[model samples]
Target: MVPSDFKALIQRFYQLQSERIETYRLFEEGHEAYLRTGPHYDFEHYKQLVHEITQAFSGISKEVLEIKGRLRELDQADLCEHIEKLQSKEKQKLELTAKLQLAKQQAQDHPEDEGCLEGIQEIKHEIIKNKEALSEIMQDFKYDSEECD
Candidate 1:
């Protein structure tokens, strides 16, 4: 059978997935380093990480959305839906992370208070859960591409 024209889109989607995974790992490391409980809690480093992650997130989200609609047009509605779900989760994570950054910035003014890290772990856990679900979706995407062969 001839290869499907949509195979390139699928490969691009995988690239987005990989980029997100790399960014998320960096985020997790930054988060750990920013916590007061950690020995290397540098406010400046955390701030830089937040900025980097935000930029990365924006880029990935833009591409994911573009691919999402394109996938739908290519008659891959199921794959589109899966990506949309992941997109939604990623948006939620980004929003919560922004809020966390704001809280941390304020906490910097009051180092005596230890409430800054309150919900950080919760948000991280939520992201991990969503990520696992999205990984399964990616597996489905891989199988879906088999039709292209």
Candidate 2:
């Protein structure tokens, strides 16, 4: 594939990866909400969503490897490092989001108390910043190559 084709492939991989990640995120959110509200919602839906997300992620993992191989600039270790970082960051984001939701619920339950809402918002802000940094890292490979041309 030409460089343009490779770039397009990379972009598509990122899009699919994002979709898969978002699916998992929704499952996480649903799980958290269920934990707070007891048996009020369809917890099974979240479980199914998680299953589907895992399947989607499995498919994308193969595609990511194939695309990276075609790009010829990334080795197995490099790809592994990126995958590890993405996975770690994603897990952290989910955990932080869950904590934020729990804190919000506590604040709601205690109307007069402001228990760690500011801290929760700050954590959320940091998560956003971390996500932006991850996005930059993902793009770094493509942009760095362009600079050589």
Candidate 3:
């Protein structure tokens, strides 16, 4: 039987992928909405949105690297460190994903105030990219595990 932790990790990866796709869909919605809003909204809001999206993208890219590290065969200390980083990064991604979704919802609910819609789009795009990268990492992990068996 597979270790519980490893199995759970694989499940979590797939779930993250699904969520990432959903984020992309939401982002498309945000882009269309932004076009509809025209220039009535403050440009500062768009800039802020881009900034937040950039942060989320950076955070997810970092997490993908951590996950790749965790998949490597390493000593106990290194494994522990990588696992910790993976957990931390996962938590951060979840938090940012929730924040992005909330921002998108708020924008949709209040079309008059695009607020953070631009940031939402950025988050969605980042999620799509990161999700693919993470999935590849997970596949590599699986293959490595199988090779060892």
* Leading candidate by TM-score: 1
Residues 1-149 of candidate 2 have per-residue lDDT tens digits of 23566457557757866775677677567666655664355557656765775576667666666765655553334444555566566557656665776666565556577556776678779879878866766666445544433
CA shift at 49, candidate 3, in angstroms? 27
- Judge candidate 1 at residue 123 and give its lDDT: 58
Worst 10 residues of 3 by lDDT: 73-82
Q: Comparing 2 and 3 by TM-score, which wins? A: 2
Q: Rank the candidates by lDDT, best first.
A: 1, 2, 3
lDDT of 2 at 46: 52
Candidate 1 lDDT over 1-149, as tens digits, reads: 43365777777878987898799788877775677544445778777888998899889889988988887777777778778777876777667666665566556656677665665456557767766776777777677666545
Please write out the lDDT profile of model 3 over residues 72-110, one tens digit for every residue: 423224433434444454555656666775676577667
TM-score of candidate 3 versus the correct structure, residues matched by position: 0.42
TM-score, model 1 to reference = 0.67
User: In model 2, where do residues sit more than 4 Å from their true spots?
Assistant: 1-9, 20-83, 144-149
TM, every model: 0.67, 0.56, 0.42
Q: State candidate 2's TM-score.
A: 0.56
User: Which runs of model 1 end up more than 4 angstroms from their true locations?
Assistant: 1-5, 36-41, 93-128
